[model samples]
Target: MTVFVDTSAFLAYLDRSDENHETAVATWTQLLHNRELLVCTNYILIESSALIQNRLGMAAIRDFQELFIPLLRIEWIDESVHQTGVAAWLAANRRRLSLVDVTSFETMRRLFINTAFAFDQHFVEQGFSCLK
Candidate 1:
């Protein structure tokens, strides 16, 4: 199964200062050991990298990418996905959620990936199993 690596999880993994670092690290280790397939979109990677740089530092973000990017099956979705994501955002709870979040949801729905490795409650609200 290919787990959708959400920004929340990516942040948790990269920022050791995070409150969820322990849990995220444990889960990450387990997943890696189990050889669980992983996936993400360029949408997620861009946001995640920026957040990592802002919250932690540019050095950390660079290091994280060196270790993480090759591990993911990046879904470079197109303009169609962006259009669908925009619609999903409007239909979702509010415009508070970003295109990355909405697109992650839409992409998951389209790919039939029911499990999302996310700390965001929106995933659960959207009827997907959030891997804590």
Candidate 2:
């Protein structure tokens, strides 16, 4: 089964100080052992990249660029997907949910992916199975 990766999970995995770091690392290790097909949208990538760059500095960003990113299948969000996500976000009118999150939801739905390797509550609220 394909698993969608969220920014929260990426951040936790990269930052040792994060509260979820240990759990994320264990989950990641299990996924690696199982050879799960991980996937994520470009939106998620941008969010994670920016966060890592800001919090962990350029070295972390380089690690993401060279190591982590290549491990997953990227679901590039196109115009239609963007529009759909925008519509969903607007319709939901939830202050907590960002456009990127909605885009990830749309991407997951489009790809028929139901599981997420994430620490984000939004994914669980959206009915996607979250690993942690």
Candidate 3:
């Protein structure tokens, strides 16, 4: 199975101090053992990398580039994806979702991926099963 990876899960997996770190690690290990295909959008990578660089420092970003970048297949966000995300973002009123979250949702829908490696409740609310 292919699972869409979100920034929250990535951050938790990389940072030991995160609240969901243990769960993310265990889930990641299980996915790896099961040979599940991991996928992420370019927007996700950008957000994750920026968050890691700003909060965790350049070394953390470097580690992410070296250790995590090669494990997953990247789906580059094109004009269509951006437009879809913008539409979703504008349509959402009750939910305070970020552009990245909407973009991820669009990417997942486009790829027919229902499961997400995420720690965000937004994914759950969007009817996507978040795997901690």
Candidate 4:
């Protein structure tokens, strides 16, 4: 099975203080043990890296890059995906909804991925099944 990795999951897994940390760790371990295909957009990488660095410090960013990143099949967003994401973001018109989240939704739809390893309710609101 292919599971889309989101920034929420990354943060949760990396930050021990995060409320979702335990669940994230358990789910992540299961996914790795099952050898599930883990996927993510390049947008997620950028977002995660920045958050990790800001909240957890540079060492966490290193761990994110050297350890966690290798497990993901990154889907790089092009101009078309970016535009589509922007349109979705505008259409949603929700203040808290981010362009990255919309792009993730688009990426999942394009890849036919139904499951997401995420803590974000936006995924559930958008009708995608979230692992955590």
Q: Provide the overall lDDT of each model, using Cα atoms, as 2-decimal numbers.
A: 0.87, 0.93, 0.92, 0.95
Candidate 2: tens digits of C-alpha lDDT, residues 1-132: 799999999899899999999999999889888999999999999999989999999998998889788899999999999999999999999998999999999999999999999888999899999997
Per-model TM against the reference: 0.94, 0.97, 0.95, 0.98
**Residue 61 alpha-carbon offset, candidate 3, angstroms:** 0.8
Model 1 bad stretches (over 4 Å): none
In model 2, the Cα lDDT at residue 17 comes to: 100
Residue-level lDDT for 98 in candidate 3? 93
lDDT per residue (tens digit) for residues 33-108 in model 1: 9899898899998998888888889888777789888889999979999999988787775756888988998899
Best by lDDT: 4
* Residue pair clashes in candidate 1: none
Candidate 3 per-residue lDDT, tens place, 54-75, comes to: 8899988988899888999999
Q: List clash counts for every candidate, in order.
A: 0, 0, 0, 0
The digit string of per-residue lDDT tens for model 4 on 28-91 reads 9999999999999999999999899999999999999898998889999999999999999999
Better of 3 and 4 by TM-score: 4
Ranking by TM-score: 4, 2, 3, 1
Model 2 ranges with Cα > 4 A deviation: none
Q: What ranking emerges by lDDT with the best candidate at the front?
A: 4, 2, 3, 1
* Deviation (Å) of 4 in candidate 3: 0.4
